[model samples]
Target: MTVGSRRGQATESLRQLTEAVRTESSDGARLVANIADNPICRVTVDTGIPCVVLAWGSYATSAQLRFVHECALDLLRRHALHKILGDDSALAVIPVDDQGWLREDWFPRALEAGLKAAASKCPNGFFGKQSVANVMSGAPVGITVRSFEQLDEAKAWLQTVKI
Candidate 1:
């Protein structure tokens, strides 16, 4: 077989593998939003919690963050979701620069979009947890953030948040 043909086959195989992984990962969740070129941030509406859920992949980029912010705001507006559950346990780290954008831009816009409360599964370590905590601290008044080690706990907390 020609070298170029071999390379084409390999690319197709890799694409199939990625699609398989994505299908398996999102098996139970209903996909609600997807941004072109930023498929890692899977936005779904959780049937169990009846809230919008942002499930992160292994890593996040600034462009992905922006996609997530915009998608979430759209979800909030369309569904009138008062609570958002961000499952960031799969995420490795929040970029230092994106942290400010999240705090100053995304968070406030979320509030204005009618999000009353949010729950995020804290990342696995002290530093990761601290990073999320720091961002949460700057959230606008009336917007509450609750951190949890488990998704169930987060969903439960979200259920109790008053609209």
Candidate 2:
């Protein structure tokens, strides 16, 4: 998963990006394409990996969850697209900020949803645990980065690991 966006841009409103995941293959490569969209999250899955680049301080609310559900469906569709792409490695990449999730209760629910989605998408239900191992192995996915600087570092760390 790689993240990139234009700098110093502000959004009109804050929204949440949440999704559900389903993997069609046990051996597939999932690459998350996290777009730098504000207000509404713009998530793209090139493979099964759903990469998301969100605004710094966007908030998640009950109304926002509906949007999350929609995103989830889109994420699943992208995973299916992975089958066509001919990549057979199952993986999930989630982006979040500690400031966004810890500051608000609503955010955690969305985060949980993302976690669940990632886990469910794993072919053997072992990808989630494997990701945890990856994290502890000096790299981590589904990690909460505090700022873009840290985000960049996290991305670098993630790049070291093969999906």
Candidate 3:
């Protein structure tokens, strides 16, 4: 897809919510940690030069979701540093589901839990709902979503995203 081209509605919407700030590059390597505001609290991990939607989605509860969303800024800071330190590693992406965000008054707790799971499994790139569920279910690493209609875009983005 061309830059600025609108393809998938969800992907496009997520992109619109993200704002890139403070980009850094050294020796052909790039690091960007940007603040993203979406329907849910989110941290996008689009480093490694491929640009992936590392983390997206908001929590269900407004208050807790807001708190988690706010915390995403902090998370971004840490994520940036992590990427800077771990050069040549793939990014991780975690897209929380809307149901989890809405049905539970546990967004903050869930976010913390989810973030921990994602970070641990970040060695593996990309995660879908099932993968995330499994991580929450006690797996060491989050599951990776293996199928997508737009496989090329999905994979390309997945490579740059970290949970």
Candidate 4:
């Protein structure tokens, strides 16, 4: 390879590494986006599900998750979204710091933002389960977050929750 091409590749590699480190930090979820239209999350308000579907093993986890929560928050503010269905089945292990941000920074605001009940199709594999459990553990008394193996079961359970 030519020297110029090698230098370019090295620069790209450094950029990727920097971004990865920056996003994986514990406080990364605090971006609080002005708008939420990212690929990592879909807000299904019209279908009457009141859900946010998250992509599994997203590389840009920090920005993606922040956007997802931001979108959910926006949906809650505009529509009074109370119930949430989680289909975050994944093969990747979430970073502890990111999980911490979810628990500390996001969950409380989400509760105040109108999240009353959540039924999750638990993320696949051990690390995913553990990460999920840790994040859900921070929920206050007013809200509920339940995990289920099957998506149908989770949805059915969510339907039972009052308002």
Which candidate number has the best lDDT?
1
Q: How well does each candidate superpose onto the true structure, as a TM-score?
A: 0.73, 0.29, 0.22, 0.69
User: Candidate 2, residues 64-98: lDDT per residue as tens digits?
Assistant: 32343344434444443211010112222222332
User: Please, what are the lDDT tens digits per residue for candidate 1 over residues 45-162?
Assistant: 7656667888776565455455566667777878877778988787777777778888987787688779888899988766667778878888899798888999789988998877
lDDT of 1 at 47: 59
User: Of the candidates shown, which would achieve the greatest TM-score relative to the real structure?
Assistant: 1
Clash number for every model? Answer: 0, 9, 12, 0
Candidate number with the higher lDDT (1 or 3): 1
Q: Decide which is better by TM-score, 3 or 4.
A: 4
**Over 4 Å off, model 4:** 1-39, 50-60
Poorest stretch of ten by lDDT in candidate 3: 21-30
Candidate 4's residue-wise lDDT over 1-163, tens digit each?
Answer: 9868955874575456445544665333332222233233344553456554444434336555555555566577677678778776752456788788777877876887778888878777888788788878888767899999987898888878887
In order, the Cα lDDT scores of the candidates are 0.71, 0.29, 0.33, 0.65
Error of 3 at 10 (Å): 30
